[model samples]
Target: MIYAFLNQKGGVGKTTLSIHTAAELSGRGRRVLLIDADPQGSSLAWSNYREKANFTVVGMPKATIHKEIDLLAQDYDDVVIDGPPRVTELARSIILSADIVVIPVQPSPMDVWAAAETVDLVREAQVYKPEIKCCLVINRKITNTAIGRDVRDALAELEVPVLKNDIGQRVAFAESAASGSTVLNQKLSKAAREIIKFVNELRRLK
Candidate 1:
């Protein structure tokens, strides 16, 4: 399965979610491929810092995504794409290349708008990749915000299948990414548990 973590805005935990999801999948003995489609190469840099990881991090930039991703899917059980942080043509191409696209939205109005835009793009791409699946993920959520609840509720109102677990705002997510360790490799935290739950949900979908 191919999962693309994407959003139009930066700082929404797109790459963080992608990397941790990849780590969780790999830790469960799945052959995972972490594709760093982001030109920033956050996932690739994290993989380099970790030195040893359960799966391979392929920092392939924007390219002939269709052919490349098709060939890549041949070897890995799961392909997680850390796409560029903008809902442009490149990101849509990546989404179309994916079997499933996970739109990571931070618990904020702006992020929600960005996520909505990305989802719109994905919907438009459905004219092409009709079988591709796109889902919304509330990343960096706060516990008390009614606004957060509103966002989640709105997604539910739209009948979108949201992962029950939400990745909270955490320093651990940044710490591990900076150090090239996944949240799973770091000390256990709410973020790690959310990621684990997410991986489990994704596996069940497969």
Candidate 2:
């Protein structure tokens, strides 16, 4: 299966979620491949920094990714795509190529509004590929904040499903990224448990 982490706005934790999800899947013994579809190549750099990454990571920052991904999918059990922020042709192609699209939205008005274009793109893709599963996950949510609860209510206005698990604003995420490691690789922590639960929820969607 192919899963793409996408959002029209930046700093929504798409790359962080993609890296952790890929690493967790690899730990489960799945042959995983992470494709960095963003021109920024953040995932590629993360892979480069890791001396012993379990899954394969590559950069494929082209608009024709939908055409190329199928051939690459045959070699791996799962593919995780970290998509670009803008709703360009490249983002559309990445959405079309994935079996599932996970859109990470920060719990704020600006981020929620920015996600509109991405939600529209997913809806448009669904018209052609109705089987494509798209979900909105709350990322970087501050604990005990009214804004977090309000964001969920606001997101209900969208025509997509919202994931039950919301990733908290944790320092561990930043630390993991800096070290080129996943939360799962760190000492047992809430961040690691949340990521594991998130991955399990994603699998249940399949």
Candidate 3:
């Protein structure tokens, strides 16, 4: 299975979510390959900082990745693509190359509005590959806030399903990233639990 984490707007936590999801899958003993499809190369940088990782991370920041992913994905059980931000053509290629496109939206009026373009691209890609599945996962959510609670309804207007399991605004995610590690490496902490629940719900999508 191939999963692409994408959002046209930056700072939506696409890279964080993609890397943690890849690490979680690897922790489960599955062969995982994380493709840094963003020209920013955030995922590749994370891999470089890490001393050791169970999974492999590679760079493919190109609009033509859809043409090359298959050969590179052959030996892996799962491939996770950390997509580029503010690049429509690259996003389209990532969407076409993925079996599932997971769009991470931050809870806010602007974030909700910004998602329309990404949703449109997903819909367009669906026209070409109807089997492709796409959904929104509310990230960096501030718990107990009205916006966080109402984001699902806001995203409803875009015609994309938002996942029930949402990741909250937590410092653990940043700390882990800075150290080239994942929350899962911290054991069953709050952050790790959130990611676990999120990924479990994701696995049920198909």
Give the winner by lDDT.
3
Off by over 4 Å in 2: none
Per-residue lDDT over 32-123 for candidate 3, one digit per residue giving the tens place of the 0 to 100 score? 99999998999999898886779999999999989998998999999999998999999999999999999999999889988888999999
- How far off is residue 33 in model 1, in Å? 0.9
lDDT for each residue of candidate 2 in 1-206, tens digit (9 for 90 to 100): 89999998998999999999999999999999999999999999998888586999989999999999889888999999999887489888998999999999999999889888798898898899998899999999899999999999999999788999889899998987887777887647989988988899999999
State how far residue 165 of model 3 sits from its true place (Å).
0.3
Per-residue lDDT for 74 in model 2?
Answer: 88
For candidate 1, write residues 31-112 as lDDT tens digits: 9998898889888878879957689888776756756788888898888898887638778678778888888877767776
RMSD of 1: 1.7
Worst 10 residues of 1 by lDDT: 153-162
Q: For candidate 2, what is the lDDT?
A: 0.91
Q: Give me the displacement of residue 193 in model 1, in angstroms.
A: 1.4
| Per-model lDDT | 0.80, 0.91, 0.92
